[model samples]
Target: MQRVAIVGPGGAGKSTFAQALGERTDLPVVHLDRFFWRPGWVETPRDEWRQRQSELFAGDRWIADGNYGGTFDDRFALADTVIIVARPRLACVVSAVGRSARFHGKAVQAAGCPERFQMVFYRWIWNYDRDSRPRLDIALARHDHLDVVELSTRMSMTHFLESISVR
Candidate 1:
């Protein structure tokens, strides 16, 4: 997959998977969340976000991680493969909690990090309800041209990674 997009609910390990895939394939990896979020967790304007995405996809090979509905069409058009990380809601919540702790502990100053009065773990877990998954489902359906690989369980994700031929 020359251009792969990793999609799924927040805290689903999409960023980690994208990083791993980028290492394995020796391709550039782009975290969509980083692009969408400005300093202090403020969202970048839609037009600006789209313009940045356009620049990233202009390259031939990249592994993009995160689901920004605003740029779905632009991203899908450039992606040859779509890897959906469909972990259970509970698992997603747990992961988010852990990630929030680790990220904050490290003091990784980034636009996406939750700032004053916003607890990352608490916010992320409660943010996505059942409606979010259906949105992702719709995105997959709409992008029929993409080779969709859905990993609904942790075991499946490991298996899928093992099956990929590391060039």
Candidate 2:
């Protein structure tokens, strides 16, 4: 795929998958977290965030990984393929917790944005299927022409990766 959009809830391995996919396809990887957060967990202004997303999506080839609902439409419109990493809530929670522990007080995905565990984030992960999936579904519906790959398990993700015939 030329323009790939990797999306899912926090700790769903979107960044990891996007990195792997980018390596396999020789495409540049764009971590939206890097652009969305300013510093110290501060958020970028909505207008500026959207503008930045547009510029990122304007690229010819790239693997963007994030779940910024506000700019989903713009990214999806430009993406030729969408990869949804849909792991179980328990797995996501565990992954997120472990990541936070490993990267606490240090930036991981975004510069100047130290990782930290939050109950609210965990709650969002736990309720992603019920609360967020519906919105994702609607968004996906809007772009039926695009190839959408949903990896519901680790094995499935591996299988999908292995199936890609990268040059």
Candidate 3:
């Protein structure tokens, strides 16, 4: 679908899925992390972040990935399709840890922001279902017009990706 938004916890493979989907659909892929984080992991100011997001959303076609809850509504409002990667917490944590190891000191998703493991990040991943899922649920409810796809497991995610046909 055009104007897709891929969202989930930190380690839910949002970037990977967005890349694959973009490849298949031939849509421009936008990684929110790249825009939200400046050098040295500094966050863009909230107002500036919103402005950047608005500019990104001005495009007619794109596959944007990341769970920047602050700007989620804006992105969701523009997206025709929303993909949620709802993997298990343990799986997410493990995936995050693995990503940190593999991409240590190198920018992976967020440009100029090298991957690093932190206890707080781990805790957030651990508590994502309890803390973030409810908020996401509310957002999804508010956006009933959007086509939402939830992949609750690795098998489901694989199947969903495999089922997509390039236009």
- Candidate with top TM-score is 2
Predicted candidate 3 versus true structure: per-residue lDDT over 101-153, tens digit per residue = 99889987677889887889989999998999888888888888799999988
- Identify the runs in model 2 with alpha carbons over 4 angstroms from their true place: none
The TM-scores, one per candidate, come to: 0.86, 0.96, 0.95
**Highest-lDDT candidate:** 2
Clashing residue pairs for model 3? none
Q: Flag regions of model 1 displaced more than 4 Å.
A: 105-129
What's model 2's overall lDDT? 0.89
For residues 34-136, write the lDDT of model 1, one tens digit per residue: 6777666777788888999999789999998887866677888889998988887788877776776666534243454562234554565456556565666
**lDDT (0 to 1) per candidate:** 0.76, 0.89, 0.88
RMSD of 3: 1.1
Clashing pairs in 2: none
